[model samples]
Target: MPSKRKLVAASAISLAIVAGVAAIYQTFGGESVTSSVAAAAPPAAEVDVAAVISQSITDYQTYSGRIEAINYVQIRPLVSGTIVAVHFRDGATVNKGDLLFTIDPRPYQAEVDRAAAQLASAEARNGYASTDWARAQRLLTDNAIAKRDYDEAQNADREALSAVKAARAALETARINLGYTSVTAPVSGRVSRAELTVGNVVSIGANAPVMTTLVSMSPIYASFDVDEQTYLRFLSHDTKTTVPVRIGLANETGFSRQGVIDSVDNRLDTSSGTIRVRARFDNADGVLVPGLYARVRVGGGAPHQAVLVSDAAIQTDQEKKFVLLVDKENKVQYREVKLGEQHEGLRAISDGLQPGDRIVVNGMQRVRPNDAVKPNLVQMSGDAATTKGSS
Candidate 1:
């Protein structure tokens, strides 16, 4: 009976061992379940991609510039006098020969009258001299008087003629002085506020005070400088074909106004290695003003087939610029690219890229060189149209 009890205890102990082993296996099975879940997950990273564009691109070179008045004039009095009247309101638009100010004309007028009186007296004397000379000639022909007397009368007549000429010159001088008393605009432009008021004394010549200033209203100039290389290229271009330029104001976006290259400086500035260039634009609306900042762009070259990519897709690594391009197998590779002018929203890839290369446009932060990616191809045409419109 004691041996049977011992055998039953041993069987119970064995059953307990089997149960503990099964429980430990169930706990480790959770790890196998996690391994299967990880294996089922996607390996490639998802990224937004766009194809490189191929199109005819017209290149442009941008520059910083300023607006200048085609015609600028400083209005000053031509004669020294008291300002008696102001003909134009302050800051009024003036046309050529428009009266702006009137200096006191009474003094000049009095001088003119004095000259006229002298001229009249001289003319009367000349008439008398002519009669006397004629009488002297007749007397000499008939031998009715001494030769010295005739000679004296001829000499007197010649002296009177000389007096008339001097008087006439004096009269002309007085008339010119009188005309100078009235100040008129020499150009058609918008005038600044008068610097001198009525009752102020104004003077003539270079040391004279400027009464006002004028700047032309229509067809203004936009001046900028181009580098020596660009200047040479411009000179090498066909002379007859005008180069087109565009400009934008400081507050504006893109180059909204158009112009043509009007002139180039005769010599390049050796110190700066640049040449001055001026472009003219229509300003009939009077919106363009002198001394305003302008963003200018000159035509670079003829339109040609070029590869384009979004500026957002470009990546700068150290000193070099690059882009992330995906191959046929959707493996991302780093490509070094040479960039040209940016137009619309797209940048011209002058070198290092070809048409139809897929590039990462968005999600670039999630990508790296040699990364395997699940690329979502997006239509670049729509983006191009939007960019072109803005540009």
Candidate 2:
């Protein structure tokens, strides 16, 4: 027979074996196991979810360009002389035909006086010759004077008339030179500083120095280059007639000024595979200036419906871009998407999404694929904070 200590040890061993079996059954047996495990699992993650947005979106192609003046002119002296007076202040707005400078007119005035005196002297001589010719004609008719004297009188009268015509031409030239002494603005625009100051002599002809520069202010031009593909697209649309364009300064974000396509290059540049394009915008406020850096957007295509989603919701995996989608059962799934141009802080999804699909816009990092989520459905439009969940 066994001792009392052996009996106690055997009893303890049997009880431990029974307890272990009971614990296993509770953990993996049947409905109790399922209920216990389900109770232990944590609740679904709360997330901000938004349906894909659908709208008629217009696409635009952006390019960096420069602003140019519609009309630019370099003011130069017409006649050579010392600048006796400056009629315009530096950087002042001037009108067409406004006096800008005055050259020394004394020399030209003296020439005019001299030509006038010569004309008067020639006229007096012509009168004397005419009278002599008349006397010779009468003497010739009477057959009392030599034909040589009559011929000399006729020749003298013709010479006097020729001298008078030459003097008159000289006087007209002198007057024109005198007028050139008063330099005038050739265009209406803001003028630059005077290149030649008062008392400085300026010369005319091809070597003449530019006195100032002027550029038209109201309508300005913006020039840019477009690639072969873009050029073809523009040609298909016939952009020159009514293609819309927008412009913004370098420091600005969105294009604030509107313009129209004015011209396109005749041929594509073979070296760069691009074509030159120009746009014209009204600058009535005179804020746009030449050589300014510009950001331009050329409109493309007609309006079409596009699916957009918040860009922040997109996640990248290696080379593939994806988004977290919430199904009807509130289960999260990974969806791959193709993207297009971004507008208003959202990205256009070209494929792999529908307008009615729900995407996890926020708290995506906290959820995993196939995980359940407590979604707060929100409208993608308007203020993000003000949006309320429909679910």
TM-score of each: 0.76, 0.76
RMSD from true fold, candidate 1: 6.2
TM-score for predicted model 2 compared with the true structure:
0.76
Model 1 misplaced regions, further than 4 Å: 1-51, 236-241, 300-302, 324-334, 358-360, 363-391
Writing each residue's lDDT as its tens digit, candidate 1 over 1-391 gives 9999999999999999999988887978878878999999868888878888899988788899999999999888888999988888777888999998999999999999999999999999999998999998998889998889888888989999999999999999999999999889888889999899999998777799999999888889999999977777664456713776899899976788998888888888999998899999999888999999999988755789999888878889998999999999899999999999877667899999999898888889997888899988775542431322233
Residue pairs in clash, model 2: none
Per-residue error for 230 in candidate 1, Å, reads: 1.7
Question: Where is model 2 poorest over a 10-residue stretch in terms of lDDT?
Answer: 382-391
